[model samples]
Target chain A: MRETPSLIVRYVARRAVPFIQLYALYVLGHGEDGPGGGFQGGVIFASSFVLLALAYGWGQGRKHVPEKLFDLLAPAGCLLYAGIGFVALLVGGAFLQYEAFVGEGADHATKHHAHHFGLIGIELGVMLTVTASMVILFFEMSRPDEEGAFGDGASQEDVEALHDGSAATEEAPDA
Target chain B: MEVLILAILVGLAVAAVRARDLMASVAILGGYSLMMALLWCQMNALDVGFTEAAVGAGISTVLMLAALGRIGRREVGPTRAPLLRLPLLTMQQRLRRARHLSRQHHRSSAWGAILVCVLVGGALLYGTRDIPQVGASDSPANRAGSLAEYYVTKAPEEVGPANMVTSVLGDYRGYDTMGETVVIFTAALCVLMLLRQARVRRGDERDA
Candidate 1:
């Protein structure tokens, strides 16, 4: 079996994923003030995962970030978003009306607090959904079948062994 | 200034369509979309601009690249010579000879291009007719109760979000936004399904 790529590439990608994820969070959090938003930030963050998959291998990438989790999280994020609106409706306000959540507060501070809560909840949901969707898309696109399996253009059997090895590890006894 | 921008947009669009290379065409199309987005921003259609920037500049380019990956990159050479010419042909001659031959070889492609251009141009013209006057304060959007005012003034306070557009999309008109999200999800699901690996049976049918 041939060796993987340089440790430097893996190390760089490993280091970069966190920073990229952090930037995505910043973009999502500050979307109201900046050009970057949930969608763009999500794709940018997902690019790191694609880079990681390229640097390492798909099996390792999938092990690190499972496809099933992404599939679940994508819809879950949207559900959380809609659930917020449902909460607003339950509060006797119109659909998605945050004002009802504010109550009859006298002070401006109280009103601002309520508003922040609602916005944060929604933005977080958007970020989760967008990021998951993008990562899933990358996975779907770059996934190897019979042709073009490894990063170094390796044989299909090697890729299959790698995949099966990862699957076996996933099913292994806990330490 | 508007005319200059429009001219640039038209030129970029022509270049996008006329480019021989698929990747070059896709890149030019992205530029054309971005220019059109800038024009939308200049026109104060911020929502439209946002949608166009995201869908046109981003998603469309990505989709085109994915398509290029599936389809080989090599461009087909142009045909050798022009085939047909009709100076004062009768309807029967036109239908039987010109139209039928065109449908088989080349004429349909040109006709399809012309038809698409005409349809798109007509739609743009029709939409422009109904659009509110540029920078008019009394436009329908402006007069729609306190929505615009809320976006300007109370947006930050109400949503605790500095970006009014984000607040509006994620909170105020969230239902419509949810629908848009669903549309994206559906599209993604469809693409995934269509492209998913198909299982080949052991005793499959005979080869063609």
Candidate 2:
């Protein structure tokens, strides 16, 4: 990795990252947002994490967005999405029926508000899941210790065995 | 203006193909994507342009470079190409490298596959040329009684979001968006399941 691990680069990254993350949040919240949402914002958010990983190695990188949290958040985003749909179902409407959230005979404005809320909720779910997933994929691929450990168990062991026989015990030897 | 950008894109594409260095090719590919994104923006598709800029120019280039670190960096070149002397010093060494690449991938097969891809892509582009101009108000896509018309007219009152796209995606076509979220979630789960094997094995060892 061609890492420019200097204070100046890190400082610039540190200063710029907050705005990147905030812009990602804006993309996530599309109620009155500018163009681009969910997927774009999620990738942007994930990039911030990836940048930290690259600048400071995955060791410090993993700390910024803990591995365990990423693991949970990835799936949780999808569950949140399904749960919202289930809520709509419980409200006596068809699946994903935001109109049902507004009481029957409610004013048009109320319906509009309900729809807006539902859309924002699901978009948030997308953002969370996408961001977490992208970061996870990045971490998995970028891990210095774990080359060719991406597939099933058998292949991973074969790769490890091959590495052990040929090269130095190079990849995160202690860890 | 569009023609100028397209001409630059064509030049970039040719340069990307001719660039012997894997990393250089990837960089040129990034430049091509930027031009494409610019074209999208010029055509007033800000949302599509934003996505292209973010994904194409941002994470993809970084990821490709990172991947290049794992897989070999400089592509193996043939002996006849004296220009490749930077990496291949001797004829024997270049031939050996050429044989290695041929073993993995036949050069002719690669060219044939690329030709097929270009042919199919051209055909598809030609087929789609007759479709009404993108976002044209009077196009059949936006005519009354169509779903697009319904969303545009009724989305605000019914779905509530001022944006028709969001309303259709999150409210009208809510199930699809939910599924999309689940798919993204599942992607994370799959990565964890596959990549976190060491932790899982440790748990199993303790149980055993």
Candidate 3:
């Protein structure tokens, strides 16, 4: 009935999760300069949460990062993205046309300011959407079934015991 | 050269369809898409090639894997010719009718008809002498006053991003990208809603 994972395994998982999230952020931030982008980076970042849930159990991860928060943030991110484009439209240019944001002056400084503002806004929107979606997906996938309702909000120890029991059954039959 | 490329494309497509293993078929499809992307690049359609790379190779492969995970991996049986049972007709009459048909006609009557049509269509394409040569600088895509010129010249200055295509897609065509994102969001929401177990309301308790 021993449920807890070994100290070594727990230690490794705890350390690894933060690094994975950081890497995802790096990928998202540098997406324009590199091969990676919002979609790929978001998936990778979300996977870190999935890994955390797998290793430490879903309850702990959910306690740390709630699904409801991501649910709200996901749409908010989309709205933020759309809002930027709407701003451009209101400025007398076509939707998302940055030239309209620039003042009446024909100089490069005006153009550069508009371009910088537009790119930053779009990147922020992408980052928000990607992070929220990934976390939400992981939560949905790892939610407990009715049969395991007894183990709902179960600790990491309980999950380890279940995993070990299944592993033992498979190994015992072969041996 | 174009003929050789077309022949290879045909062979790859056939292999993708006929492969017995689902994983193998998926791999073949990936190869087919990669080849098609390369062909696009060679034809000087870089934008199309970029899109094919992103959607065909990246998204499609992930989707296929996700689907395979949900479905069982093993192939059930060797793919047989679809059974065509004429319930009212006698077996003898069916045999007689099948024998009376020519082999070419029989083959063309089945799914292979589509293949034959495609091959004939390709042959007909060879007769279009007025068609511009591939990657011709004077082609409409490269002609004066074309959109490509504007994209090449103004995109970097206007968007402040070195990647002109990304700028055009994310900024210049932001509305379209926003719509596409909404479509993706809707699809994701639909999948989540359909697959999710119905929630039990408070006070509606039943012991398992």
Candidate 4:
């Protein structure tokens, strides 16, 4: 494949990403009333970045959402989830009891609101983690081997040796 | 509707298996997922349908494409021999064809895989005989005082989400979701360590 796809592909990808992201947000927020939630939303969101990678290059996609951002967002989502659970526990309720986000004396309506908010918060956490992980996987897996330090040791001779089995070793046998 | 989608799914599956080009196989698999998502929608499992569309069809296709970019797309193997021969072949030609057929690799393994698939599919179909049809009120899980009955009846009032799946997943099964989130995060961390460690070692070698 070419390093950069054709102009038509790039133009369409650039135009489509924002709409895809907006729809992902809709899916994430509208889960209670509709057919999507964190996992689906996050995958859709990540796909926008994947589109960018396909049209441009892996380096270009990584430029938009860098590895540094991945390191931050990945853990931040898990922390948010654990923090919500601990908040309920610290207030003398079950670990993830959503009603505990409100005071013990709060009325049913307030507790209902709290529970709704808590579910949204959890979903947000899921979206962040999933989105980061997917982008990370894409960038890592599609990375050009030439740019990697791990490939430095793989010389032409090493490849030939593996294929032809004809290179005689100079080193002595193991002691 | 279900039958149409299922037929398309089976066709896509066979096409994916028979395709020699890895890229075409990935595309066919994506179509299979699309048909599967439609099947889920037909069964009234909208959330599962959404997941199948996004994860199975969309993200997985992109991921496989990325992997394909890393590895060459053409599969390295012996070219398939033609399945037909003229009925009036000479004795020498017949012997040569027989020798060629014997030289083909993986024919036995292919038969073994087909046998395994048939046995497993038959066993699963046989096992489904005991299960009730969808939405049967008297089914084990749907009967009075059962957990599903309790969740369907009381979850909305108690958990405050009109969507029972949301309420159940986010509240009743909060720990499970949390654990899943942690597991995903852990996977990212492991990838980071494995990929980054090599770069860090290279840096140390540079310093030396």
> How well is each residue in B11-76 modelled by candidate 4, as lDDT tens digits?
888778766567778999999998898888889888888899899998889878767765656567
By lDDT, highest first, what's the ranking? 4, 2, 1, 3
Q: Can you tell me which runs of candidate 4 are displaced by over 4 Å?
A: A147-175, B81-103, B106-118, B199-208
Model 4 scores a C-alpha lDDT of 0.80
* Per-residue C-alpha lDDT of model 2 across residues B64-172, encoded as one tens digit per residue: 7656655644566552232323363467876776787677777899889999999999999999988897778879888768888777788666666555666666677
Q: Against the true structure, what is each candidate's TM-score? A: 0.68, 0.76, 0.62, 0.83
Q: Judge candidate 3 against the unseen true structure and give its global Cα lDDT, from 0 to 1.
A: 0.63
Model 3 ranges off by over 4 Å: A1-66, A89-94, A130-175, B1-16, B19-60, B77-134, B197-208
Pick by DockQ: 1 or 2, better one: 2
Per-prediction interface RMSD in Å: 8.0, 6.5, 7.2, 6.0
Q: Is candidate 2 or candidate 4 better by DockQ?
A: 2
Better of 2 and 3 by lDDT: 2
Q: Tell how far residue B114 is off in model 3, in angstroms.
A: 4.3
TM-score of model 2 relative to the true fold?
Answer: 0.76
Report the TM-score measured on chain A for model 2. 0.78
Instruction: Give the CA lDDT, 0 to 100, for residue A171 in model 4.
Output: 24
TM-score of chain A of each: 0.75, 0.78, 0.74, 0.81
True lDDT of residue A27, candidate 2: 82
Best by TM-score: 4
Task: Tell me the tens digit of each residue's lDDT in model 2 across A13-122.
Answer: 87878898998888878534457677788989999998887777667778899878888888788888888789988989877777788879989888778877777777
The residue pairs in collision within model 2 are: none
Instruction: Indicate the residue-level lDDT of A76 in model 3.
Output: 78
Candidate 1 segments exceeding 4 Å error: A1-17, A51-64, A90-94, A102-107, A148-175, B1-5, B40-60, B75-130, B143-150, B153-160, B197-208
The lDDT of each candidate is 0.67, 0.74, 0.63, 0.80
